[model samples]
Target: MILFFGTRPGKTVITQLPDTACPYCNQIGTLQVSKTSSYFHLFWIKLFKITTDTIAECSHCKRVYYENEFTEAMRKELP
Candidate 1:
């Protein structure tokens, strides 16, 4: 029998953050909080989640930031 298994990432938009200064693009209101989870897949179907990650996305410059890079204020804003 042939078995197929792999890992996949699942993402969720936590929230649309309010207008805030973007360190990368120096823009306001262009950042959104998102959550991503890595999952194990079996036969092309998701089996169980392995790990999770939180990040921020900038619409202007299209930059992605991990949770460790988030400022104190930004951390508080996460949902």
Candidate 2:
């Protein structure tokens, strides 16, 4: 028999910051905050979360950035 074990990244859109502008695209009301988790999986079944992080993205430019890269105003806007 063979067993498969590996890790994958899962992402959830926490909230939309309609008031914030995307730094990369310079687009207004396009920034969104998302939570990402890395987890181990067995046979494609998720086991447990290994790590987590928050990110900000621009719908217009498809730019992704970590929470620490967000400005004070942008950070406060996250849910």
Number of clashing pairs per prediction, in order = 0, 0
Best by lDDT: 2
Give per-residue lDDT, candidate 1, residue 18.
Answer: 82
lDDT of 1 by residue, 11-79 (tens): 665777785767887888888988888999999899999989888988889999898899776777666
**Candidate 1, superposed: residue stretches over 4 Å from native:** 23-28, 60-63
List candidate 2 stretches off by more than 4 Å: 23-27, 60-63
Q: Pick the candidate with the highest TM-score.
A: 1
For residues 1-79, write the lDDT of model 2, one tens digit per residue.
Answer: 9999999998665788888888777798888788878999999999999988888888899999897799877977765
